[model samples]
Target: MFKIGWLRIANGLIYLYILAPLAVVIISSFHPGEYLIFPPQGFSWRWYEHVLMSGRYTEPFWNSVKIAVVTTCFSLPIGTLAAYALTRYDFRFKNAVQSLFLSPLVIPTLLFGIGLLIMFSALGVKMYFTRLVLAHIVLTIPYVVRTMLASFSQINRSIEEASVVLGASPARTFWLVTLPQVKSALAASAFISLVMSFDELVVALFLTGPGLNTLPIMIYSDIQFNLSPSIAAISSLVIVATLAIGALLIIFMQQRTRKSTDIEDPKP
Candidate 1:
């Protein structure tokens, strides 16, 4: 009982530590003063109103959204296919290939960004949007691949084999049987890819050129030059948005799991 109580206390402290900064930022957003401050001078929504009306971060926000969306679209399918291949097939240098895809997670983002910048410079690649999308796809694919690999490994091979024995083509079995079994994994990969790509900063800093502003870049620039309550407001908005998205994804994955369970073990 003592150990369990201590563990609960420790977990609560850890969660509080993680959430403290977020609480401060959200509270600061309501500051009536022009400048951001802790504990907030007084409660007011002026900053949020300004953020909504000024349109300062609007374009960059949309740019980030578009890049993130495109990154997810390409990364999810490519990563899923790569994961499926790695999981379902045996091939030469398989471990090496998997390592190569997941290398980004271990490598320093700054170093990876620098390497990409150098490579792009040598190739004379100047299209910032295109370059960013490609970079994000490369970075996000490993996440999808890793998540799906675990999910796929957990699925019963007999189920997939049954589909194959029932005269379903390999592609058909994959699309109909194997894929449905891991819908939660797919959703998880998609969420990770979307959020990572959207919140990406280091690579964006190295890869993005002028006239191609992203929300992170904008926030960074503001922090450097313009630190104000509006910045707090925008940051708070992003935090809330991220939390909302994560909640939705969790709900979606739970519903998917429940539905699959009901299908497999229906009550009489």
Candidate 2:
């Protein structure tokens, strides 16, 4: 009983640590004053209005959406291929190839961004929206690959063999048999890639110049020049948006899991 009490206390503390900052930010965002203050003097939606009215904030928000969408689109196919190769096939240098594909996750983001900027400059590639999209895709691929690989690992290989024995081509077998098994993982991976690309700041900061600021970059610049409740308002908005996406993904994956279980075990 004493050990259980200590464990509960520790868990409660950890939860508090995680939620304290978010609670503070959400409260600060409602401050009636122009600048941020804890235990706000008054409460109002004026800051939210300011965030909505600001072109600087809205433009970058849109840019973040475009970049995240493009990043997911590009990353999904490449990551899925890499995951399939890693999980399903035997090949020379397989470990090396997997490590190389996942290297971005291990490397420091700032260093990676600097190297990319230098390399792109040398290649005469300008830092623009398309380039930013490509960079985000590179950064987000590892998450998709890792998640999909986990999903693929859990699948039974004999299903593929059974399909082939039934006269299905390898491609047909994969499309008809393997894909349904791993669909939940793909959905989860895509959501993760989308979130990672959307919330990314370091690479975006280095790559984005004038006319290409993402929402995070805009928030960074705004904080640098001024400290306002509106910044908190923007942060709150982003936090809510991201949480909504995450919750939807979780709900989707749960439904998929239930459906997969039902397919696996039918009742008479």
Candidate 3:
């Protein structure tokens, strides 16, 4: 009984620690005052109205979405292929190569940002969108690779072989047999990559050019120069978007699972 009581207390504390900031942010976003404050003065949607009507936050938010979408597209294929190579092929320096690809995850992000800036400068690459997309892809690929590696590991090799033996081409076998098994993992990786790329600011800071500011950059700038509650409104919108994405992914995966299970167990 004592142990159970202590465990509940610890769990409650953990919940508080995790949710306290979010609760504060949600509550403060509705503050009627010009400045951000916890235990908000009063409820109002003026800040949200400003965000929707003014192009300031909306532009940067759209920029973030565009970059994150492109990054996710590139990261999915590259990371999945790298993961497949590591899992399905036996070659020299495999472990080394994997480590090299995953090195960014271990290295300091600030250092990576600096290195990318220097590399771009040395290469005379001054294009803003190009640099931003490339940097975001680099940052996001590791997430996909990590998820793919785990996804591929759990796949049944015999099922793949059987597909190939039963007149399916290698590409067909992968698409029809191997791919569906890991669809959930791919979705999860895409989510992670999208979220990370969307929120990424450190590398973006070094690479962003004129008119290329992302949402986080905008928020950071706003916080530095002003104490407007508009920041809170924008942040709340982001939180809502994230929650909506999470809900959609969960629903998608559940439906996929149900279909897969239905296919396996036919009823008359």
Error of 3 at 69 (Å): 0.4
Q: Model 3: per-residue lDDT, tens digit, 132-151?
A: 88988888888889999998
Clashes of each: 0, 0, 0
Candidate 2 lowest-lDDT run of ten = 259-268
Lowest summed-lDDT stretch of 10 residues in model 1? Answer: 33-42
Comparing 1 and 2 by lDDT, which wins? 1
Q: Write the per-residue lDDT of candidate 2 for residues 100-201, one digit (tens) a residue.
A: 889999999999989989988889887589878988888999999999888889999998999999999998998899988888888888898888988899
How big is the positional error of residue 191 in model 2, measured in Å on the Cα after superposition?
0.9
lDDT of each: 0.94, 0.88, 0.89
Per-residue CA lDDT of model 1 for 39-81, tens digit only, reads 8888999999999889998999999999999999999999999
Q: Which stretches of candidate 3 lie over 4 Å from their true place?
A: 255-268
Residue 161 displacement (Å), model 2 = 2.3
Best by lDDT: 1
